[model samples]
Target: MTGTELVIDGVTLTAGAHCLVEDVSLTARPGEVIGLVGPNGSGKSSLLRAVYRALRPATGRVGVDGADAWSLPVRQLARTVAAVVQESGAEFDLSVREVVAMGRTPHKRLLDGDTAEDAELIRSALAVVDATDLAHRSFDRLSGGERQRVLIARALVQQPSLLVLDEPTNHLDIRHQLDVLGTLRRLSATVLVALHDLNLAAYYCDRLYVMRDGKVTASGPPAEVLTPHLLARVYGVASEVIVHPRTGAPQVTFLPGAPALATRVEADPSAS
Candidate 1:
């Protein structure tokens, strides 16, 4: 897949009289991985909900591949965009394979059965998330991290041009978190993911959008957007953004409970 171009133009989201997201705009070029970073209740999830069509924008448009997302048919939209959100409900009495197979529903008739390609995709997706052994086990019986991996596999099998994920590593351990984000970094599909971990976001994302108080306060490459001053302003925490010696990716080091000790730290371009 060449991936899809995503554009969120002048979007505003509201719940009753309360505004959740206001005048937000962003874009993801085809095959680019975009990261949304924010503190809790900063409207990251709400903004994502609009992109995935779970919530309608009160004022702006969500575009995928030059077409308005809300204007597309439900099945058509599903075929173009696949999302793995945080509040995945219980999947009762279904095997992991069965749950992953649900991704094929958009491409198949109600009476149709799994094809060879479908089976292969399912197998590959499971293996990608290191969940191949759990394919035969019950989905509901799995732990939170296992379930999160399975859900990601499900989204992968959908073969959409755009993938929207909210905290894909929420319940994962350190190893699994790196693996999942690494997998996303290698995908050809355009990815828009919300992350609370600044280090992971810095390493995985091609570009980052920093959100606060229902608005995008800063956005750019990881080196430009993840400054100590920005972190303190948006997240109310003191942090130092350092460049990794080997990989050269921005790494965040937080100063817990000591704002005075946290000074602006930028990666020195001259350092070898």
Candidate 2:
């Protein structure tokens, strides 16, 4: 409710004759977190790529803050939309502070020096991701979780109205996963994240978009879209959907395909 709004209209992405995403249209409201979930090869990444301009839709339009995103200058777009992508290799071995400072590139003129304000913004971003302590560390030497946080800090330094993240929790431990998602939830910017963790998606997302094959299979609040029937039909998995005891959020527990007898193994008294 405090950042930019996204309006994707009739968006379609295709690779040669194969359609990746088709006729996908959705609005992401300011200060709202929307989760995109699907099985592998279901176009969740493809849809997000279109939103961030990594992949231009073969047809349709993506509008951010009421203007066509494609119509904006690339630099202007970069300033408005910050993305945390899956790519994490930095061959140049930049320091953490330097990597974060890169986020301010869009706001500065070519060959411009870093102003005091820019440095302050970088510090602030680092603080947001709790990475300030590692500011002087080599980015390449950090663990995967540390690197992920630094990248997020970099995106935060951009001060964009819209934030897009793809599998942001990858390689994170449970605690770090919660920390990262919690940080995203607290940001004022609009967020659209692709997640494979259904429980995390339900816990953090204000709305959900469930994709299958190459189209949106369901879109709504988590409680509405994450029902057992939908899970079975879309994911080919039988699941029990329940509300979280604390947050009252929809939680899913999948039932494996094997028979119940195989799933049940009584504890052995001798082993105990």
Candidate 3:
């Protein structure tokens, strides 16, 4: 399946009277990996929710392949956009395989059972995320990293053209983090991911959208967007951005003074 183009135009989201996202706009061309990087409360997750139809924008539009996302039917939207968010609702006693099977729901009739192709997709997804061994375990019993990988497998089985993942590496260890992010980079689908680790964002993303205070502060290739000045200004961290000789990707090396600077900024709210 071909990747879908994603466009967020002038979108604004609110929680009661407090704005969560304000006029945030960005684009992911077909088959591109776009990263959203920023500190906590930067609205990256909120913007992603709009794309996957979790939240309706107060102002502007979320477009998938030129069609307005809000105008699509629930099932249609689910087929086109798959999401793995940070917050998962209670799974009760469902098994890992049972949870992943839910992804096929959007494609099946009410009473239809899993077809051969569906079974193959589920198996392949589990393998991709290295969760095949946990297929029979109860979802509630899995570790946080294990659960996260399973959720990603569920999204993969959906066969979406566009995938939106918020903090996909949250509970993962170093090896699994690299494994998961590497899998995403190899995927043919358009990917929009929110990442906290600047180094990971720099390596995996084809282009990046840096968010601060609910808006995009910078958007460009990793090398251009992950500069020392931008890091200090947006995250209040002192750092150096260098190119990795082997991978040719930008790598961030934080200075010792970064934490103290961040602490000072936090102490004085007006400093930011």
Best by TM-score: 1
Query: Which candidate's lDDT is highest?
Result: 1
Write model 2 residue lDDT over 1-272, tens digit each, in one string: 15899999999999999999999988899989999999998998888888789899899999998998988999989989988888756554889999999999999999998999998988988887778999999998899888998998888888889999999999888987998899889989999999999999999999999999989999999988887778877888767776665677887888877222122122333542
lDDT assessment of candidate 2: 0.87
TM-score of each candidate?
0.96, 0.91, 0.93
Q: How close is candidate 1 to the true structure, as a TM-score?
A: 0.96
Better candidate number, 1 or 3, judged by lDDT: 1
The list of candidate 2 runs beyond 4 A from truth reads 258-272
Ranking by lDDT: 1, 3, 2
Give the C-alpha lDDT of model 1. 0.92
Q: Candidate 3 local accuracy as lDDT?
A: 0.90
RMSD of each: 1.6, 5.2, 6.4
Note the residue pairs that clash in candidate 2: 1-30, 1-31
Q: How high is the CA lDDT of each candidate model?
A: 0.92, 0.87, 0.90
Number of clashes found in candidate 2:
2
Expressed as tens digits, the lDDT of each residue in 51-152 for candidate 1 is 889999999999999999999999999998999999997765999999999999999988999999999999999999999999999999999999999999
Candidate 2 displacement at residue 265 in angstroms: 24
Task: In angstroms, give how far residue 249 of model 3 lies from its true place.
Answer: 0.6
User: Candidate 3 — which residues are off by over 4 angstroms?
Assistant: 258-272
